[model samples]
Target: MAGVYDPSVQQLRSLLTLAEELHFGRAAARLYLTQPALSLQISTLERRLGVRLFTRTSRRVEVTPVGRALLPLVRNIVGATDELRDAALSSLAEGGGLRLRVGLTDCATALGATRRVIAGLTTRHPALEIDFRVVDLVEQVTGLATGRIDAAFVYLPVAEDFHIQPLTTEARVACLSSTDPLSQRASVCLADLADRPMVSLTPQVPRAVRDFWSVDPRPDGVPVRYTAHEVSRVESLLSAVSFDGARAFLPAVAAELYPRPDVRYLPVTDLPPCTFAIAWPEADGDAPHLALLADVCRALRDEGLPTDPPAPSPRTDPDASVASLAERQ
Candidate 1:
């Protein structure tokens, strides 16, 4: 327990928001508070909890191990609080108090298209209460299929049952510790990481999902090693790569969305690219709001897909399915 020091719901939301933004200024803006105020809240939160929730420096901020493990629970609390707050509101102009809940598989990713589409939706229907719920990968699929979620952005290799829209298929990049020898190179091939142990996902993950992420069936026929550490959260996995002697293969989008001083993302020359898509069930195909979302997606994607690494690739981006984390662990 936190003793007699109790934090308000808004304070907790501030913690969640800051963890998502990973920047004091941006997180403050989102909460409509000044930078100093946000700093105070975070400091107080850390002091009260007796744990350092985030690591910060002049260049970047990152969630600490404790913070990553606590996120799923924190998110659940925040959602319940928001739902209660909304129920107390008597009226809305357009949405009439109806909540459009969209499930996100990622907790912290700055995706461009996701931002624009959400922005467009807000501009067009300000009255609609959009609850962007961060959940696990299985939940992302199950939630949509069962109507627990209005829609979701999921990575490729998913079941064919859902109506899907191809978003991005970017090259897979190698994630390594900044201090590792390979980090000195600008680019790397899969062979370079043959000896490094990789962070493992939860055991329940399907074999296909595991194989794709682990780069199983290597071109060189080299087997991979697994670290003792297993993570379901992206932050935790990144932490492993940074502090532990581990390596991973992730979508190229990570180079930007998750810039870290202790980690280096090098494009892998030999691995195949992974795809991400926005999906919904056939049952919701005719929903009015979903129709608007579909139209917005088409227009925005046609303009161009997200090109990651600040380098020109055919199509890429944290921009496409920033939801790639969908906790696809």
Candidate 2:
């Protein structure tokens, strides 16, 4: 490779860190370098690569399309290098067992799929040690990209760099305050909530993912009204609905996992169902451990023991009531 084309591992590491943080100062702090030093490194890398990695303004920083495209490749390179180093050290240690860290969103945990998956993995790989980390929905993609977690059970429509295996598909449901008039309905249509203020995820969540969850632009093409308060966790989101009178749309599994007297989950008759899947770095798809886990998931699905609960049936009339959406579905 030419001299200019040969960027050091540290340079690549800095680029990956900056891409994750999207803030020069914070990325500098994480890398233990001054902001100026980090900027110089990024600029040098871009000059050598002949591509602008990021677009920076006074208030915000955004990665360009090229930067997004390169991010996973850089991450895989760094991850493989680190794994090689770890492997060398593990070889010198006694009775070193392989460990895989799996990430889960709240919905995954609530549905008991993570537990079943872990159990199956343990049975298949007796010596493997599995660790489960609860990650917020918005950060699951970032977690996978940066190798913070080996694989994650997350909602669909992830970036192109991920390999997603469909797990379970469930109906979409709305979370509204019990006192809200819509809550009285057996099932609500997207148009019914058109005028109500909905709770939305923070901007950290990708636009497409957020829009999908928010059920934006009711089938009629007008955007659903959303409150200013953006939540990052399911607990906070439900609390907002219970007390703040804000509505939210989530998977039917959420209704099963979290049953609150103050909130009602009503099926959306028109919106498409949400699909949750196992997402991992596409570069690492062929690794034995990841492959085994994926196999376990597929086996469970084939056996008809999905991690998610069954989707509840929609109510035919507002006056025809049921105990809860979970029971109906």
Candidate 3:
């Protein structure tokens, strides 16, 4: 008995290309092979299969009935082979070690929890390398979309195309100058700030986000007045409030992270809390390690170990679960 012969992927690839082009020269050019080489591959494939695959005339080339029948099968094989190759390459990359590029906004990095999250992630995946980039609020979205960063820790109300995993939600506070009378109050409301000059962020920040931070309209339906200063960085915004007698709203964590003798953070009693989340491209949401990172964040939050000193209980804690906060609102 004779042994069976298996066709090589290179031969099948040649056959597939030839079937699509139906021109020996064109197929050869596409495959980066000489016409004779392509012809030899087709001939070899036909000989092994014991079937004729093409009918060649001086004018044109046509696939024989057998060739037509095998065309779809060959295409499927090639597609599957390519998928296998890609999977193998991915596995190799993971085995050798993988790097995740993460973006962080100024406020996000200011969180003590952010550092702990990164530390936990590294401990969990010893083979993983992290590349952290600092991006501003508006640039975080663009960075994820452009593949400049794989993931980011950012505030909520971003583009709908991103997949957001909420990490923490904290109460918002008003940043005011120590000289301001409002600074004496334990807490303040949007109505109290209705006539005050609020520091406006640059136009690059989304209008909705800016509106929310500016506390756009007083609870009584009056528009919050804007100061002449338009700033971009957190330091600049704080400086404007500290020296210019302007006011701005920030996440409560900002109060803890950036304490200044000249600035006071009074809780905005009636306003909703600011939600911080991990955002990634919706397309790559399920890619390996992202879920693990989210899990680590959740664990850290649950343990109350996210802050510098770590809160003792959820009741006394300033941080709350993203899901629970959303549910309440």
TM-scores for all candidates: the values are 0.57, 0.64, 0.60
lDDT of each: 0.68, 0.75, 0.73
Instruction: Enumerate residue pairs that collide in model 1.
Output: 105-326, 306-316
Provide the lDDT at 28 for model 2: 70
Look at candidate 3 and tell me the lDDT of residue 6.
Answer: 80
lDDT per residue as tens, model 2, 205-302: 88888888887756789877778877888898999999989999887768767778888888777878877677889999877567666656654643
Native-structure RMSD, model 3 = 17.9
> Once superposed on the true structure, which residue ranges of model 2 sit more than 4 Å away at CA?
1-96, 298-311, 314-329
Q: Candidate 2, after superposition: displacement of residue 105 in Å?
A: 1.7
List the pairs of residues colliding in candidate 3.
none
Tens-place lDDT digits, model 3, residues 1-329: 45456888778988887887899987875565689999999999999989999999989999999899998998898778867754554454468566789999777876655667788777655566788999876678778889999999887778788886665566677788888887776666788886678898888777877887886766688867888776767788999998899999877667656778788777666887777778888888666656556545544543444212222122222222111212111
Q: What 10-residue stretch in candidate 2 is worst by lDDT?
A: 320-329
Report backbone clashes per prediction. 2, 2, 0
RMSD of every candidate to native, in Å, equals 19.8, 14.4, 17.9
List the pairs of residues colliding in candidate 2: 312-329, 313-329
**Model 1 CA lDDT for position 18:** 85
TM-score of 3: 0.60
What's model 1's TM-score?
0.57
